[model samples]
Target: MPSRILFVHVCIVVFLFSVPLAFGAQSTADVPVTKELREKALKDILGKTKELPKIEKEYVIGHGDYLRVQVYGEGDMAAADISIGGEPRSADAPRQGRGVKVQLDGRISLKHIGDVEAVGLTLTQLADYLKILFATVFDDPVVTVVLEQSNSQRYTVMGKVANPGIFFIDYPITLVQVIARCGGFTEWANSEVTVVRKGAEENKLFKKNIMKFDYDDFLEGKKVERNIFIKSGDYIIVH
Candidate 1:
């Protein structure tokens, strides 16, 4: 009788352990679809999410930069020129020609205006400063500055893209636009995308599920919110 009782106890232990193993296997099988659902939810909120990198607002002037200086009503200094750093040109040199290069100290020398710091200032802000400086000599000197050529304005794209590299942009760009420029995604690309923005404390991730959209509805411009605006220095990962 005691032997029969011991055998029963052992059987109970074995059955209990097998029950947990069976449940664990079933739970594991459910995980993939759950992950996909979570990804779908994330996409709906973040749009085409990419990891945004740290963006600093420091200006480092470089060669081939075109600057247009206008002095309000004064009008005498209204001209566009490039930066080509060197000694003063000879009197015989062409007056309206040649690129203007930033000096080693990030300064540009203009006729009658002397040396001015061109780095770290946006064109509009720089114009205002020039206006104030010129005001010291000319009465109510209105100033305007324009950048015809610039090497400093650039952003980069990478990961799960056909072509990943640095891109130069002259105007505002969106996340979908950047992806299109990079040649779209690959076969293994995930509907979810992440963007790393500049100055963000952490990376922002976004996911998009292609399965939920109706082919005809999307084509008719029904779902335009899927494409989100992309900022500078955004890293897009389609995985």
Candidate 2:
């Protein structure tokens, strides 16, 4: 009887150990990845490989925008000028041309032309318009314009970056280039990035993951959607 009891106890122990292995093998086999399953996994890993956001060519003029205007044949009118007090004046103002303000309405008071709209129009466009306006008084007037101080053109970079300050972007800039300007990411930065832009009614948000692919690949047109062109006043947050 003692021998039989010992044999039964040994059998129970063996059976208990074998039960886990059997179930583990069966469970793994039952969960075999099919062709469809493999494809789905690849898709999830690769993410959406479609085109990224294109760099846009748009700008808005803001306050304290220094402008240099030159009228061919009119030496007095053709000079380096600054927008002071929402008024376009010669660079050599009474007080060294300081304390100038560009109005939100985008209007600049010119000597001959009163209240010229300078915000919406580019420097070149403003020159053409000025030529047309000056043509009424002077014949065959040639006009040239250049931007000196771009106080209103700026973008903000925050969160996880070495330098989280407002950057002045005069022209269109890419996400990778902008990050480089900000001194790269911090140690605890999350791979995901976001941009908040002011819309017509509310703000819009755009999110991207930086860890999945190389930043160079995204900037060099591989994933265009990830290389969005940053606009003035847009905020980039790298969590």
Best model per TM-score: 2
Candidate 2 local Cα displacement, residue 14, angstroms: 99
Per-residue lDDT tens digits for candidate 2, residues 1-239, read: 99999999999999999999999986764474665886677667767794434534434456656566656667535223543455434222221232223456776665565566777776656777988988887876777766656777777877898878777665668877888888888998855566666651332223232222245465466755666677777777877
Whole-model Cα lDDT per candidate? Answer: 0.60, 0.64
Q: What is the TM-score of candidate 1?
A: 0.49
Most lDDT-accurate candidate: 2
Cα lDDT tens digits, model 1, 1-239, are 99999999999999999999999986764464454686667667767665334444534344335566766555535233544545434312222224344455777676577888887777666776887888788876656676655545566766777877777555667766777787887776765565655565442333331112222343478655545556545555655
Clashes of each: 27, 6
Question: Runs in model 2 with CA error above 4 Å?
Answer: 1-60, 76-105, 199-224
- Given candidate 2, what's the lDDT at residue 201? 38
**TM-score per model over all chains:** 0.49, 0.54
